[model samples]
Target: MSPSTQRITVGELAARFLEQCGVRAAFGVISIHNMPILDAFHTRQKIRFVSARGEAGACNMADAYARVSGTLGVCVTSTGTGCGNAAGAMVEAITAGTPLLHLTGQIESPFLDRDLGYIHEHPAQLAMLKSVGKDAFRIRNPETALATLREAVRLAQTPPCGPVSIEIPIDVQKMKLDLPADLSPLAVPPVQPNLAAVDQLAERLLSAKRPLLWLGGGARGASAAAQRLVKMGWAVVSSVQGRGIVPEDHPASLGSYNLQKPAEEFYETVDALLAVGTRLRSNETLNYKLKLPATRYRIDANALAHNRGYTSELFVHGDAEITLNALADRLEGRMQIDPKLAADVKRARAEAASLVDGTLGQYVKLKNTLAEVVGKNLWWVRDITLSNSMWGNRAPVLDHPRAGVHALGGGIGQGLAMGVGVAVADAEHQLGRRTVSLCGDGGFMLNVGELACAAQEKANVVFLVMNDQRYGVIKNIQDDIYGSRHAYVELHTPDFAQLCASLQVPHFKLADPATTRDTLQKALAHGNGPVVVEVDMNAWGPFAVKFAGPPKKKEEA
Candidate 1:
């Protein structure tokens, strides 16, 4: 308890910094700039170094781990292209509102500006973070290392949790430091929901004959509140990020709803929408086509606190857990659940689900069959691809109590990596739920290097591949807009099963869709570290609704 006892090296200080974050595993490969910090920490009982096959996979695995465990997940990577390759996964963690701390090796210190012949000049990492809605900093001086570490953990774990980066220059790591570990644990102000706003929101719902409670990332820990809200009897539509925050089978919930432009009937006539946590992203709101009487009552922590004028009609500046609880309290005191409203939500949900199923029936019939065999409450992480539209529509039974994370904007090649993170989280939290992720064949190859992370760390995630030999989304666009012209989008994919085998991963190939049911069941039920079940199929259109040969007019009279 003396000042002498407090002194620790910057490397040692960094380990303690992560330990303060309550991070048990630091997943990433060791590199020159980070070797000291990573090696020193290997002996730290509170934290262990998770050796991943590649840094990107390590970062992604950490991102998912953070979301699942509610602890700041950390990953280390070498700088330059290493950091750039991490961009896709970082964007995933940010858009999904998952908390993650990424540490990347800097180009020593001298090469930062002049390039001093340092192969990797990375002065642009902070810019990258800001662009992705993440916070980042560089530690050139060992003096500020503690402060920088604290900030990274603090911001990553902040409400609307997202990724944060810290670049450690070699100089900062090896510099003889005489500083004490003044590391205070990440201190975040308790986000208390605004009761006044909750009351007003309840007022609108009390009278809304067709009110809908559309939830998203902000509703992370408010499951009980969500069930209570359903008891008040409003319809709920979930966005991609909003999908798992509430139970999919909840009677009031209308599975995961995709771009309303594609399913216009569901939202075009709603009396009111309670959009919690969702940014009302264009994809979710059909490019802001949700004709809210006015921009008044969408509840999001960021919009409410900052741009009150542009945020929501009933602004509530707090996390979803707090806001939903307050709203639940208000509803308990005020509104009586009318059987009519409950019945209406049920009818609307069933109708929408049926219409959507009919729209994409061709594809969901296949994935749902496999998902059913996989069983209820199973966690599914989707990387953006041609199959995204169909799977999002199916809202495959969430076989367990866990959240799903995906990039808000369409970004691909992250499924394998995120699975590594989520699998790590699933194991760490000791949750009994099985984890499965759907990755496009294209995405799987891009991040397949991370398979070693799963191998080395033994993350228990099963990966299912929709192995159409092309970038399916682009193929869909070219097919629709270019008269089915074959462009540069087509791929002559290598043996996908062979590819997984090369990565030392056990894989099974479904050359035909007929075997998909049994293939997925075996993969999910497999006790191996991780398995990939690749389904070979051709690319389809963008949620193509097969009409009866004729293009119907907007108003067929």
Candidate 2:
């Protein structure tokens, strides 16, 4: 064989492929089944392999890494239970449409799919991965390893992107293979929009007196295009996953207050609704009961998204970035949007912000304090918790498309792990940015072990643990509807100071709500590694507007 195409283990080839793909870092727990691949990573020292404490945390890290870095996030895991552990995180990646590659190990080729109870072997592991991932594949032999990896990455990075899982058997990973001469990764272009449809939509939008644009996570790549539409007097709002596509602080933006009373009222005056790259999810749309404009249009890469949740007058199947650019090109300077629309949007946003501030009650200080500290400079990562559901999701306006990273799947306990990933990405790019992860006492304890990983990596993160010592949302629901007979709501919360002490992480306690800003500043001052700030929510008092659950459906007369 030529010197340029020397024989090497498939494991080494996988590592080289990832390097060629410009993958800077990967995350997962190390295990014997996947040792070959990790060994290759270690030996080459080309890519940073983060050793997470659990497979789930590893996968979450990878997902957030992809979201923040705008690249294919790689995760490695062992076979069977290890793969199972990563399943939930993969689901989140799929929900968020993150471009991620999940590489996992499998049992030996001889024992695979035999159900013989071999060590760490799983029955139909690929099927489980398929259920959780956008797609799943397996390398049956050494010769097919590169081809399988290439296809998996392609499918993952394509439009309507999502996590794709590929399992390599232990034997195949160790087998010798000839390296390909051309190791550069393949490029998959975004789906082009249908120009005729784009022109028709542009004409319709031009005729409207008041037009609005709804952006979602898929719209992140189309920020400039979306901004142009906004500049043309189009009011804008976003789904939770879609925050920061256009800066949340933009005058015409309603932010993620889609279901708020003022925004809902503003929607009635909208003559044309162009929903771009958003699902119009049930939660944000008040279970699809929220009334929108009469003329509604949708643009998305997935053709099946047409009429999902809310029916659209027209469905344009193409990538958000591509289609919006085409539409913006035609509609520029020609739109007949109402002159008062921008002022109305501003009024609505003010009302919505007032409502949120009132609901925050004593915690409004926390929100404002964080806004001062984060200030579009740090990555805002939050898990599904009462604080996030109440205000964390909206406050502290994100200016850039990649500034916000949350659990889009509504999964709890993901913030800490995701914070590590964001910090890693921040450091990897040398952006000098830090991460502020918001968590509740309930969710913080779920994957609390990841704190060790954060400390070990010396990640730049400030974990704001809201210590209420109970499932605050559940208890609120009980109070509102279940006669306050709360069960499974109280938690045996840990002393965060002692916990962080053991982990060698700086710990701060915020008992006085007035000191919110100072406490956060001090946390950020601990610049070298991860720090935990436990907010005493019990002392902070309750929100003025109690969030029992989703809006109650009105009874038919």
Candidate 3:
């Protein structure tokens, strides 16, 4: 190892690569199989490791982190059962399309799959990953490790983004890297949608009686584009994963379409469908049964370039930002918004507001309170609400980077863990901003161990636990849909504020809605170790309407 050659350990090199990728936080229960990687993380002062109580919690934390921060969330676990245990979350990350980088330590390379003496089903573990998405790979050689990770992150950032899992061996993780001193993280190319397609699509949108625009996480970095569409007389309907792409308060917004009824109505009324930056997945598009009329256009960077199964009159390969820009330029200040349509949308919003009392009302209040404290600059890292909300990302009624990997599908425990990652990523770029995470009691309890990571690393995080004393969504179904026959849903929670205090951190419990503002203000206003505002939201709870409106038929997108 020459001095000029900059010989670093493989684990350290891996950590450095992740660091360059703006990976500020991680989750895992350090195991013998991954001690080298864990040690590498410990040495890297810039990155923080959130030691989760279980592998599921670790996976969920990474998923949430990616969703919240618009960065690839990270998680690690031992081989075999560990990876299999994290499979549910891995599947979630894949389903949700969260950009999560999962690391699992495999058996030593000596045996070489001979089944010489394996303790668990290694093949089955890796098989689960391959079955989920294309973003899964094995890190076999130290020589190609950095470049491999580079490509993984790049693929993750691509439109129709999903998870990327890297299965590294214990021996491989320990090997020394004969690599460069400094390697910048690979940057994803900004997609530029064809202006002609945007113009044609815009024209189609203008002609619609009740056109619908379904957005996915592809619009995470494309907020300006959504705003422009709002101005162009489009009845924008954000998919569950596509939540927060637009400010929910926009009058033209149709809210999120995740249930059977509204989603059916969404597609039924559509004269033209603009499935922008989405894959129209089965869940988002509901197995593509919602029939879109002959008049519709699909715009996806991948779809336009390949021209595969996508049925579209016009397809554009480009970034939402670029496409929106192209559309704006093509529009030349021409908009076709109807006054009556705007009024109708407002009336509907008012009606929805009235129906959203009790538990849902508390969610609205939670959303509003956070918005008030964070204002325009703060980003809300959300997880539970994505695939199951009427508002999706658009419900918040505030302008911030509220795009989580909700659509990416990492794991349930990722909300707080991912928030730390996003917050750290922002801090590195001097993007001095506040990020708050709204994890339900189920979501919070899943990743409670991350609180210690926050305390240890002094991560400036404010985790607001919507402690509803139940898996409120399941409870909602029981109460509203199933004659109140609730079971195995409600939870008995520990004193989360005390939990934070025991971790030697600042904490508060918000019982009164009036005091919530002041309590939240204090938590958001400070920048020490992480703080927790355990909102005992006994007033309201969680429910599931639909993950997103039904996907349009093949002709739609």
Candidate 4:
């Protein structure tokens, strides 16, 4: 056979395919069932394999890598339990609509359906994966393995993107097969928008005196179009996952302070609501009870996403970037925006910022310190902590869509792993940025073992642990609803400085409220690896607003 048509193991071919797709790094644990694939990766040395301590952390890393780098994030895992370990992180990727390719191993082909209880056997493994992933595929033969891999990547990168899982039996991965002479990755074409619908929406937008644009994670790719709309005097707000679609500092951008009082007051005056590429999820909209404008319209790539939460007056099924561009073109010179509406947006934003500052109290100082040190070079990654729920999600102004990563699924303990992934991917892309993951004491301890992985990889990440010595949110809930009878919320935290010393990672503690800024600056300026910065939340005192109680209902309003 010619060199171009040489036979190679399926595992090697898979690695080569990933490399051709421009994948620079992958994350996962090594196991016997997946030895062939991992061996190939090690031998080629073309792609860096981040050895994570757990499958869940690996998946989180892959998800964040995809978000920060704007590429297909690759993750590999072994059979059965290994794949099960990644299920939670897969849910997060699904919620955030991250483009991720999860490669996993399966039992031998002969034992696949027998339920013989093999060492790594699992009942209905493929079905379980299919339920969690956007799509799941199993490679039954070596000859078609490469094609299957390409299809999985294509699907993950398509519009309405999410994670895709592919499993190859151990025998299949080791099988030798002849690859096609022209084995290149396939490029998926972008979806187009309907021009007629765009014109109709443009006309509606032009007719409204006070219109607002709501951006979601899916709108990240359409930042230019969003900016154009904002420039036309349409005020903007974002869902938590949708932060940074428009730089939060923009006069028209409201950030994630949508459910607050000042923003709610501004919403009262809005006549038109143009939502693009967002689910308008209940949590962000205060359980879908936040009062919006009377005339509502939505543009989404997924046709099924229409009317998922709150129903819109007009639902346009199309790609957000394309639709916005078409709408902007149609409304070119025929639009006139009210000056009063612009002034109102600016005033409302200032008021909201002040309120958040007052609520944050001592944490407000930390936030400003971060902005001063990192400026726009920081990638704000957060776990589900009180600090994040209260301020981190909305307070910071991310200059770019890729600069913010959060646990959209509302899960904790994934932030450290995600931050490491973001840092590594950013370094690979030469973005020259630092990833700061804000975690609570409880969340940080959940996957604290992953700190070793960060040390090993020397990932440029700062893990800021807000040590309240307990589940602050849960405690607040008990105080409000259960008359201060707290149970199972108190937690014991390790001396983070000592823990970091054991891992050979830099460590800092912010025990003094007055020295908070200096301590944070020193931690962030540390070497290119994971650093643990523990903030004494107790010293900072209580927050002005408690976010633990049940969301206020629309009927109450």
Quote each prediction's TM-score: 0.88, 0.98, 0.78, 0.97
> 188-262 in candidate 3: lDDT tens per residue?
777666666676776755555655566756665677876776676667766655666776656776555333344
Candidate 1 off by > 4 Å? 1-7, 110-112, 123-130, 176-182, 202-205, 258-270, 291-296, 304-312, 359-362, 399-401, 538-557
- Residue-level lDDT of model 1, residues 299-335, one tens digit each, is 6667434432235556667777778877777777465
lDDT of 4 by residue, 1-557 (tens): 66667787888888988988899999999998788888989999999999999999999999999999999999999999999999999999998899999999999898888878888888788899889888999999987898899899999988789999999999999999886566677887766767777777877778787889999988988999888888887899998878888998887888888887899889989999999989988877778888877778999998888888888888888888888888887776676777788779888888988887887767788888778777876899999999888888886688888889999888989998998899899888999777899999998889887899999999999988999999998999888778999999999888887888999999888877778778877887786788888888888788777868435764753
Task: Kindly provide the TM-score of model 3 when superposed on the true structure, using C-alpha atoms.
Answer: 0.78
Candidate achieving the largest lDDT: 2
Native-referenced Cα lDDT, model 4: 0.87
- Candidate 4 residues lying further than 4 Å off, grouped into runs, are 1-4, 554-557
Best by TM-score: 2
Whole-model lDDT values for every prediction: 0.68, 0.90, 0.66, 0.87
Of the pair 2 and 4, which is ahead by lDDT? 2
